[model samples]
Target: IIATVGNGMVIYIFTCTKNLRTPSNLLVVNLAFSDFCLMFFMCPPMVWNCLHETWMFGPFACELYAMIGSLFGVTSIWTMVFIALDRYNVIVKGLSAKPMTTKLALFQIFCIYLHGLFWTLAPMLGWSRYVPEANMTACGTDYFTQTWHSRTYIMVYAFFAYFVPLLVIFYAYYFIVKAVASHEKSMRDQAKKMNVSSLRSGDQNSTSAEFKLAKVALMTISLWFMAWTPYLVINFSGIFQLLTID
Candidate 1:
């Protein structure tokens, strides 16, 4: 409920505040939308099932819940990837260069949703199957099964939906950090050459913003990896162990 309301407020504020609308902020808006979808559509049913101690909505709703949840999950990750990339461009390329345009940002947002939907629909179209999870109260891709189909689906889905986006996010932040360091060094050198005590206020402000953004990216990716790494490892372990036994 808090997530839904907070993200909805973000969207509302962005819409109403013309100055808040920018190519970079478009990614933030998309992220808010993804969070809203996950919280609003996925959480209530999950909370109900948890309280009831069973799948109250039956098989079809279970599958539907899993689908929507997975879709939003992927969307959130890719949205973060895009945000990292946007920050990298702004920081590394310098904001005055206009690293992204409104049209390009819109296209990127569209692609993020389309990419998520494509993978989310694969199971429904027979790539694998969405079944009740081990807990039997929720549904998701058959991650525990060791069959060829399940393994293949898991591998492909993980690569595109998780691994690829994770790599992009890391890469973006890596470059961002490097760029920020280099800029700071250059500023220090200029200050030394001028025999000044410190950089100009504008330069200091820019550096502060860069560091803050870097810190945010670090925290976001770290938390994300922490949350999802166990699931990824367990699934892959199941896959590898099954293959070894076979």
Candidate 2:
């Protein structure tokens, strides 16, 4: 309920307010939409299963549920990667950066969904299989299978879906911080030379924009790691035989 309502509000605010519909903000809306899809499409049935203390859905429904979750989940991950990259370009380049346009943002969003579709469909095509988890209340990739084919799929998927995106996010934010720090140092030095209390004269708008985007990106990245790290650990443990499934 929290996820559904919160993401729904974000989408609503961005859609109804014309002034909030900038290209950069469109990316935020995209993130919210992806999350909304995840919660809206998958949560109710999962809740039903939880209430029953078991997955009442049959095998086909289980596979569909897992696919929907994985598809949106992957898109959300890559969307954040793009958001971080966008912030790095805008904040680091400042006024010299090319402004984000709606068309370009839409194109990027299309690519994100396409990337997600590819991975999620691979499981259905025999790269791996979707099956109920040990708890029998949720479905996901078949992590318990010990064959080389199954293990290979998990490893490759983890590399692309988790590790690569994580590295890109970190790289973007690391440089974002360095750029912000450098700018602050320059401002302080210039202020001292001019005998002024501050050097922020006409660049307040740009500075404010950078800070806003940085703050959002920071929050997004932090929440992302918090939510997905445990899932990643579980997948890895399963692949490595660290987990014994009944």
Candidate 3:
């Protein structure tokens, strides 16, 4: 409920307030929208099944629920990648960077959804299959099967959905940190050479902004890795027969 409400508030605030409409904030809005979809369409059904100890909604609902969950999950990850790239451009390129326009943001969002839908629907199209999870109360991609098709699908999905995005996020943040650190060191050197009590007011403000952005980038990457790495490891382990999924 809190996630739903909080994300909803973010969407409402960004949409209703004209002044809050900016290219970067568009990414936030997309993230909130994805979370909202997950919380609204995915959470309640899973919770109901958990409490009831069965999938009361039947097979069609099971497949639909799993697809929606998967779609939103992928969308959220890709949106974070977009956000990281935007921050990288702004911070690393500075004045030379081309600003992200609203049209470009919208196009990026569309591509995110398209990417998500392609993967989510692949199971239905026979790339693999969605089946009830081990608990029998929920459904997802058939991760436990050792068939060649299942293994191929799992590996490909993991590469695009998890590995590639993680690489992009890490790469973008690395340069962002390097650029910020260089700027800070240059500022400190100038201040020391001039024997000034402190940096100029403008320089101080710029440094502070960079520091705050760097902190945000760090937190975002840390949270994403922590939340997703275990799942990826488990999937890979199952694929390689290192761990039994049953």
In TM-score terms, which candidate is top?
Answer: 2
Candidate 1 residue-wise lDDT, 1-246, digit = tens: 898999999999997899989787898888899989989997788788889877788878878988998899898898898888888777877756567889999999999999999988998898888887656567788876768888998899899878898888888888888987887798899999999977769646855876797778679778977888887876687667742322
Across 103-176, the per-residue lDDT of candidate 3 in tens digits comes to 99999999999999999999999887888776766778877778988899989999999989989988988999
Q: What's each prediction's TM-score?
A: 0.88, 0.94, 0.91
Global fold similarity of model 2 (TM-score): 0.94
CA lDDT scores, all candidates in order = 0.83, 0.89, 0.86
Instruction: Give the per-residue lDDT digits (tens) of candidate 2, residues 15-45.
Output: 9999998898888999999999999988898
Give stretches of model 2 more than 4 Å off. 201-203
Query: Order of candidates by lDDT, top first?
Result: 2, 3, 1
Model 3 / residue 76 / CA error / Å: 0.7
Question: Which sequence of candidate numbers ranks them by TM-score, best first?
Answer: 2, 3, 1
Q: Which candidate number has the best lDDT?
A: 2
- Cα lDDT of model 3 overall? 0.86
Of 2 and 3, which scores higher on TM-score?
Answer: 2
Instruction: Count backbone overlaps in model 1.
Output: 0
**lDDT minimum window of 10 residues, candidate 3:** 202-211
Off by more than 4 A, model 3: 200-207, 242-246
